[model samples]
Target chain A: MRSVTAENITETFIGYFGKDTDPRVKEIMASLAHHLHGFIKDTKLTHDEWRESLELLKWTGEITTPERNEFVLLSDVLGVSSLVDMINSNPAATSSSVLGPFHVTDAPPMALGADFKRHYEGEVILVEGYIKDTDGNVIPGASVDIWQTAPNGLYSSQDDEQDINSFHGVFTADENGYYSFTTIRPVSYTVPSDGPVGKILDATGRHPWRPSHLHYIVSAEGYRSLVTEVFPNDDPYLDQDTVFGVREDLVISYKPQAAGTFPKEGFELSGKVDSAFSKIDFDAILIKK
Target chain B: MRSVTAENITETFIGYFGKDTDPRVKEIMASLAHHLHGFIKDTKLTHDEWRESLELLKWTGEITTPERNEFVLLSDVLGVSSLVDMINSNPAATSSSVLGPFHVTDAPPMALGADFKRHYEGEVILVEGYIKDTDGNVIPGASVDIWQTAPNGLYSSQDDEQDINSFHGVFTADENGYYSFTTIRPVSYTVPSDGPVGKILDATGRHPWRPSHLHYIVSAEGYRSLVTEVFPNDDPYLDQDTVFGVREDLVISYKPQAAGTFPKEGFELSGKVDSAFSKIDFDAILIKK
Candidate 1:
C-alpha cells in the first residue's frame, strides 16, 4: 500500500485481507493488527527493540519441540493464557486454568479411589472430587484425567530422570459422581527457564515460579469439559502464580487425616501399610453442553 | 498477581517488573503487555485460535536460518517495518525504506562510475546520484551501497543459482559528490512465499509482489545514514508493494538514452555497451547526525 504511515498502517494491513477471507479469520487478524500497530505507535518502538523482539520470538521457536512448547510457556508468562481462560470462562462452571506445557495424552488409566501405580516416596495425599451439574446434581461416570509434579517440583515430561507417566492417571467418576486418587503432593516449580522465555523473565526481574497444584481435565456426557487445577491454599506462590492461573475457589487445604482416612474398600490404597496423610476434598462443577 | 481477571491482568502483568528493571525496558514491556491483553479481550479469542497462533509461530521459527529470516518477512508483510520506517524517518532527509532480509554484509566496492562484476544480461540502466545534506549542499566522499534483484527478479541471497554478490556494489562519492552504477534494471518480484508468511498471505488472499526498485544505503561523515529504495513510478506493483515500502518521494523515472549516451569517463561501461540504455538520476539527502 502507498504512503502507509503509522496512523494508517493498522487498517491498511487489515485491508490487505481479501473479501473472500473467512469472517472470523478477518476479525481476529484485524484486531491483532490493530493492537499490534497500536503498541508500536504508543511505544514508538525503536529499531533495536523491534529487532530484539523478533529475535526473541525466533529463539523461542527454536527451543520448542513436541514435548516442550516454549510458545505456550511464553504465552503463560505473559498472562495471555490466563487471560484467555478468564475471558472464555463460564462462571457457572468450575474455573478453568492455564494448562502448562506438561500435560500429555498417554497417562495410564486408574481405578476410582486408587493410587496411581507408583512407588515414589513423599507425603501421600488423597484427592477426592465429585462431578456435578449446575443444578447440583451428580454426573455419574464423568471422565477425569489427573497429573501432578513429583515432590521435587518437576513434571514427568520435563524431567527425563522421572518416569514418563509419573504422577499421571485417569479414572471415571463412580455412580455417585465421585472420583479419587492417591499421589504425592505436587510442589511449586519454576517454568523451564533455560531458554528465551527465561531471558525475558530475567530481563524484567520476574520469577518463573508457579504454585503447587494438581492438574485435572474433567468431562462427561451432556456437559462441557473443564480443564483445571487445584492449588494448596498454603502455597506461598498462590498470590503470584507466574501464569496467573490461580482461582480462589480452586485453592483447597491438604487436611491432615488419620491412617485409616484413605478408603480401604474399592480402593487400592486400602490401608496398605500407610501412615498419616492429608486429604483434599474438591468437587468439580460443570455446565450443560 | 492475585485476582487477575481480563480487566486487570494487563496491570498485573506489568506490575511484575521489579524496581531494578531498566526504565526503558519497563516502558516497552508494559506497553506490550497492555496492548496484547487488549487484543485478546477485544477478540475474545477462542482456544483454537490461541493454539493455532502459537503453532504458526513455532513453524515460522522452525523454518528460519541464517540466510532466511521468516520473522522479517512476517513483520514486513504486516507493515510494521514500513510503519517503523515512517515514524522514525526524518522528514527533511531522504525517506527510509525496509532494509529487507536480502542485504548482505559484504558487497565489493565499485568505482565512482562503474558496473558490478555480474555477467547476467538484461536492460542495463545507468543509475547516477549525488549525496547532499538537508540544506542542498553536496557532501563529498559520502558512502553509498547499492543492490537489487537480478533480471529474473530474485535476489542473490534468495536464489542459490546466482552469485552471492550478484548485482551488489559499494561506492564512495567523488569530489563532485556524484556516483553512478550500470546494472540490470530490477523487475517486479514476489517475496519468498514458501513459508509461514506465504501461508498467511494465501489465507488472506493477499499477493506477495513488490515493485521494482534499487536498494541504497547512503551516509556521509556528518550526516545521518539513509536506508532507502528508488522505485520506478511506472512499475505495476508500485502502488501495491506487499511490504508497504513504497514512498512517493522515492519514486523516480527511467529515461531512455542513445546507445552511446552511457557515461564513458571514469565509468567501466565506457563504450563497452553496444545497446541503448535507460538512465535514472536520483539524489539522496541526509540530515545532520
Candidate 2:
C-alpha cells in the first residue's frame, strides 16, 4: 500500500485512473483532479469551509429540477460554462455561447413571418435573419429555433401565466434563406437569483442581470449547427451578463422603427401598437462539417 | 455594456466579489472562479460533457443524507479532503489526517482500560496510548475519542448488524496521561463504493480499500485539538488507504502476545480468549493554542 500524503495525493488519484480506456475520460479526470486539489491547496481550506462548500453544493443540487437547472446556473455564474463554450467554439463557424438552462426541446414551429405576440402587452419587434454558409451563400430551408423571456423577464418555462411556447418559435428559412418573426421587444432581465446561485451573487454584491438577448440554434442538413445568442448592443447589462453569454460578433443594434412601419414582405401587424418597434437584421453563418 | 467573452469571463467573475467585506470569502471565491474556468478551458468540455457533469453532481447530492455525505466522500476519493487536512496541520502537533465521514458525535464514554469488543469475534488487541504536550509533559484529563470498523470491515454506523457504539468509545486520560482499551484487531476495509464516487472508482479501475486504522480526536482545555488516525504498520493496504488518511508517524507496529499475557497494570480481558493478542503502544503529542 502506498502511504498517501497531501503532496502525493494528486499523482495517486491520476494514477488510479491511468488505465482508463477512453482517452477523453482519462484526460478530463486527470485535469479535474489536478485543478481540484490545486484549488484546495491554494485556499488551505478548513473543515468548516469544506463543510460549508458541501452544503452549498447540496443546496444547489436540491434546487435543481427538470425545468430549473441550478448546476448549469452555477457553472454559468462562475464563468465555467462560458469558458467551455469558448473552448469548443469552431473558428470557422459562428461564435458559440453558453447554452443556458432554459432551452426547450419542443418549441412550436411557425411560418417564416409568423408573429408570436399572443396576448403580449409590450412593444412588438420584427426579427429578420438570413442563414448563410461561410462562402456568403444562402442555405435555404435551414431550421432557426429561437426563444426569449417575456417582457416581464420570465421565461415561458418559468412562468405559469404564459403558454408553453410563448415568446418562442422554430422557423424554417424561405427559398431565399430569409426568416422573420414578430414578438415582444427583448428586455434586459436578471437571471434567476432565488436559489443557491442567487445566494452567491448576493454575498458577492454582484448583479444577476443578463442583457436583452435572443437565443438561436440554427442548423442545416449539410452544415455544422450553431448554438448562439444575439445581444442588444445598447442593453445596460451587456458588459456584465450574469452568465457571460455575450460575444462581440453576436452583439447587434436593434434599429428603431415607427409604430406603423412594416419591415418584411407580406407582414401585417395584428395588434394596435402605438410605440416604436425594434428591428434586428441579423444573419447567421454556419460551417460545413 | 462590455460584450462578455471567454477571455474576460474569469476576470469579470473575480471582480464581482472584489468588494466583498470579508477578505477570506473574497479570496476563496476569486480562486475558485479562476481554477474552475481554468479546468473548463483545459478540458475544452463539450455541451454534452457539461450536461453529464451536472447530472453526476445532482445524483451525488441526491444520494447524500445526514448519515452519508457523498460530497465529503467525493472530496476524500479525489484527495481533496486529505489535501485540506495536510494544509491545516500544525507542525508541532500530531499530524492530522482525513476525517472520514463515519465520525459520530454521541460516542459512548468508557473508563480507562475498558474493552470496546462487545460481542466481537476476532483476534483480540490491546491499544495503549499517552497524551502529552510538545514538551513531553503528560496531559491528564484529556478527552480521547476513538472509533474503528469491526473485524468484518464495516463501521458500526454503516452496518445494521452492530450496535450504535460498537468498536467506538470515548475515554479520559488518567492522571499519568495514560489511556488503554481492548478491542478486536481491525482489518483492512474498502470505503463505501456504491454512489457517484464509486462510479468514478469503477471507471478508473481503482480499488476502494483503506488500511486498518483507528480514528482519534484528542483535545484538552487550552490546547489545540488533534484529529488523526493510527494505521497498522503491517496492514497490506497501509500504503494505499482509499481516503489517503495515513501519516508516516501515525503508523505503528502491533506486537504479538501469548493468549494469556497481560501487558498493562490495570488491563482485564472481558471475554474468553484462546487466541494470541496483539498489543500496540502509541503516544500522541498536542500543541498548546
Candidate 3:
C-alpha cells in the first residue's frame, strides 16, 4: 500500500467532530482544533512522541479518583480553568475567588450575630455586614454563608474528627441588610500539597499558602447572588496572595478596639468584654436583578 | 479563626515553591503553581465554577483506554503534545512528523529495491533516496525503514490477521548513499474517532484527513537519526494537513518512466522488468558527529 500525507489524514480524522449540533461545543472544539493543529505544525511532532503522550495521559486517568481529581488539577495548573472563570465571571460584582477543594453541601444555618465558632477561639470579636444593591438599598433577609481556616490554619474537614467548625458559619441579614458573628482570627493556610498540585508547586518554586480571608456566599431576593471573599488590611501577605484572590475593594481594615468599653457605636458590640477585638466592616454590592 | 490580610498570605505561598527540592520537578511544579495562582487570581474563580471544572476533568479520566488515549488525544487537541515534540526533535535533519496510531515495532528488513506490494497491488513504484552529509558526501550502510497505509487508507496492523509487517520494511543504503524500494502510492485516510477524541471532535467541528506521504526513519553511525515523511507533491489537502506536517522541502514529484529503458547513462537499469515505476531523488543530511 501507499503512504498518505498528514494533511488529508488529519482532515479525515477530524471529520468525526459534528457540525453546528451544539454551538458551545462547536466553538470550543474548533478553537481547540485550531490551536492543536497549530501546535503540531509549529513543533513538527513525531509518532513515538505522540504515543508517549498518550501513555502519560492514560496513566493520569488511571490515577484519578473521586476525592483526587488529577485532570482538574492539570487544567487548573495549566491556567485553562482560570481562563474560563475570567470569561464567565461578572466584574462589577465582588471579584470571585477560587472555589477550593472543600465545598461540601449542607451546612447548619444560624441566626444573625450568632457564634458559629463551635470550638477553638483565639479572641472575642463581633462581626457585622450589610448586603445591598449597587444603589445602596438594604437587602433584608439575605443569607450570608461564611467560612474560613482556624487560627492554626486548618478546617474541620481538613482534619478527621476536628469538631471545630472553628471559623465556619451561616448568617442571615436583618431587615436593614445587617448581620454579625463572633469567632477567632483566621491565619493564612496552605492548600493540600500531597497531590499533583503539590508536585507541581514543588517543581515550580511557588508557595502553597492562600492568604487569610473569609469565604462568603450571599443571596437575597430581587438582587443577584454573590460568592466572594474579603481580606483583612493588616495581613502582611495582602499584596502577594498565592491564589491571587486579593482585591483592593475587598480588603477591609481590622481595627483593634479597647478590651472593656463598647467597641464603637456603628460597630455591633454593646459594652465590649475585657479582651481586645479586631473590627472590620464591608458592604456587599449586588448587581441589578 | 479570624482572617488575616491578603498580603501576608500571598508572600507565604510564593516562598513555598521557591524552596522546594528537586530542580526538574521543582521547575515544572513551580511553573504550574505560579501560573495556576495567576489564573485563579486573574479570573477570580468561584467555588461552584471550580467544582464544575473538576467534574468535567474527572469525566475525561474515567473514559480513557489503551486503545483509546483520550488524555493524549486531549493533549493533541490542545497542542501540548506537539509542542513538546517540537522542543525535543532533531532540528537540522528532515522535519519530524507526527507518528499516527499505526506503527508496530520490528518491521522485517528487506534487501535494497525490494517490493512491498504483496497483499494489495495496483501500482509499481521505486522509492530512492540518499543518506548524505550536508556537504554532499554519501554515508554508507545507513538504514532506512519505511511504512505506509494500504491502498484503501488502512494499515496492515489495524487489519488483523493480514500478517504482521505486511507493508513495512527496512532497507540498507549502498556504499553511495543510495537506497531504493518498491511500494504503491498511499491513499489519504481518516483517523479513528469513536472515542473521547471523537467526542471532543464532535463537540467541535473538525475534519481529519491525512494527505499521501511516505514515512521514513533513517540512521547511520556518527549522525543524528531522523524520523520524517516525504509528502506527495500533488496531494489535494497539502495545505490543510491535520497534523500540520506540510513542509515544502519534503514534497517530491514522482516521475513515471518506461520499465526497461535506461533513462540516464551513468545509472544501471538497462533491462529491469517494469511496467511503470515512479522514482524520487532526495538526500538525507546528517548532523555533525
Candidate 4:
C-alpha cells in the first residue's frame, strides 16, 4: 500500500478510474477531483466550513421544486451558468445566456405585432427583433419564444394568478425575419432572495437584482438555435446582473416614442395608444449547424 | 461596464464580494470560483453535462438524513475528508484518518477490558491500545470513543436491528495509557451503492468497498482531540480503501491467540475460554494544544 497522504490523495483518487471507464468521463472526473481537492487544500477548510457547505447544498435541494429549480439558480448566482454559456459561444453568432428556471416549453403561439397587455397593468412597450443567419440573410418563418415578468416583477410561473403563458409566446418571423409584440415592459427584479442562493449573495454583499430584459429562444430550420436575452442599455443592473448573463453585444437601446408616433400598421395598440411608450429593436443571430 | 468574456468572468464574479464580506470568506469564495470556473472552461463542459451535475447534487441532497449523511460520504469517497485529516495532522503525534459518518457523541461508557460479543456472532478479537502524549508519556484517563461495523458489514447506525451502541463504547486509558476491549471483528463493507455517489463510482469503474477498520475519537483533557481509524494490515482493501483513508502508521496486524493464552486479568471473557481469538495492540499518540 502506497501510504495515502494529502499530497498523493488526488492522484490516488484519479487512479481509481479503471480501464473500463469512459475516457471523457475519466477526464472530466479527474480534472474535477483535481480542482476540488486543490480548493479544499488551498483553503485548509475547517470541519465547520465543510459541514456548512453541505448544509447549504441540502437547503438548496430542499427548496427546489418544478416551478423553481434552486440548483439551477445556485449555478446561476455562482456564475457557473454564464461560464458554461461563454464556453459554448460561437464568435460568428449571438452569445448565449442563462436559461433561467422560468422558461416553459409550452409557450402559446403569438401573432406578429400583437399585444398581450390586457391581463396586467404596466407600461406597454414594443419589442421587435429579426432572426438572421451568420451570413446576414433573414431567416423567414423562424420562431422566437419569449417571456417576461409582469409589472410586479414576477414571471407568470411565479405568480399564482397568472396563466402559464401570461407573457410567454412563440412568434414567427416574417419573410424579412421580422417579429414584433407589445406587452408590459420587463422590469429589473431581484431573484428569489429567500433561498440558499440568496444566502450566498447576502454573504458576499451582492445585490440580487437582474437587469431589465426579455428572455428569448430563437430557432429556424438548419441553424444552431440561439438561446439568449436582450438587455436595455439604460438598465441599472445591466452590467452587474445577478446571474452574470449579460454580454456587450446583447445590450440594446430602448427608444421612448411619443404616443402619436407609435406604428399604426399591424400593431394591436395602434388604436388604443394615447400615451408614450418605449421600443427595443434587436437582431437575433444564429450560426448554421 | 467591463465586458465579461470567458476569461474575465471569474474576475467579475470575485469583484461582487463587497468590503463587508469576511476576508476569509472572500479568499475562499474567490479561490473556489477560480478553480470551479477553470474546470468548466478547461473542459468546455456541455449544457447536458452542466445540467447533469445539478441533478447529481439534487440527488445527493435527497438521500441525506440525520443518520445517513450522504454528503459527508460523498466527500469521503472523493478523498476530501482524508486530505483534511492530513492537513491538520501533527507530525509528532499519531497520524489521523477520516472520522467516518458513523460516529455519535453518546457512546455508552464501557469497562476497560470488557467484551461486547454477546450481541453478535463472529470471530472474537481483542483491540488494545494506549494513549500517550507526543513526548511518549502515557496519559491515564484519556477517553477513547470507538465504533465499528458488525460481521454483517454494517455499522450500528446502518443496521436497523442493531442498537445505537451495539458495537460502540467509550473506554478510558489506565494510569499507564492502556485501554482494551473485545468485540466481534468488523468486515469490509461497501458504502451505500444506490445513491448518486454510487453512480459516480460506478461510472468511473471504481469499487465501493472500504477496508475493515475501527473508528476512534481519542482525547485527553490537555491535548488536542484526535479523530482517526485503525485498519488490520492483512485486510485486502487496506491499500485501496474506497475512501483512501489508510495511513501506514495506523495499520496493525491482528495476531491470532489460542484460547489458553488469552489474558485473564481484567477481562470479561477470561473465564469463558474460547477456541481461538485475535489480538491487536496499538498505541495512539496525541499532541497537546
Residues B164-277 of candidate 1 have per-residue lDDT tens digits of 888788899998789987887889999889999999899888999999999999988878788999998789988778999988789898888777665577677754555657
Sort order, lDDT high to low? 4, 1, 2, 3
lDDT of 1: 0.85
Question: What are the per-model DockQ values?
Answer: 0.71, 0.70, 0.18, 0.77
Give the Å error, residue B210, model 3: 1.7
**Lowest-sum lDDT 10-residue window in model 4 chain B:** B268-277
Number of the top-ranking candidate, with lDDT as the measure? 4
TM per candidate, chain B: 0.95, 0.94, 0.78, 0.96
Ten contiguous residues minimizing lDDT sum, candidate 3 chain B: B1-10
Give the alpha carbon lDDT tens digit for every residue of B187-254 in model 2.
88987788898888887778898888888999999898888998888888776677778887889888
Positional deviation of residue B12's Cα in model 4 after best superposition, in angstroms: 0.4
**Candidate 3 Cα errors over 4 Å, as ranges:** A1-64, A70-92, A121-125, A150-158, A162-170, A256-279, B1-93, B105-124, B150-169, B195-200, B254-283
DockQ of 4: 0.77
**Each model's number of backbone clashes?**
0, 5, 76, 0
Arranged by DockQ with the best first, the candidates are 4, 1, 2, 3
Q: What is the C-alpha lDDT profile of model 2 across A1-289, one tens digit per residue?
A: 4666668888887766645447888888888988888889888888889889988998887788878888888988888888877887776667888778778888989887787776677867788989999888999999999998888888888899987878788999999899988887778888889999988888888888888888999999989888899987888888778888888889988888777565446564554555577889889999888
Q: Which residue pairs collide in model 2, if any? A: A1-B239, A2-B239, A2-B240, A3-B239, A239-B2
- Per residue, candidate 1 scores C-alpha lDDT tens digits across A73-138 of 999999999988888888888899987888878688788767763777788887787899988999
Fnat of candidate 3: 0.28
Which residue pairs in candidate 1 collide?
none
Answer with 1 or 4, whichever has the higher TM-score.
Answer: 4
State which candidate, 3 or 4, has the greater lDDT: 4
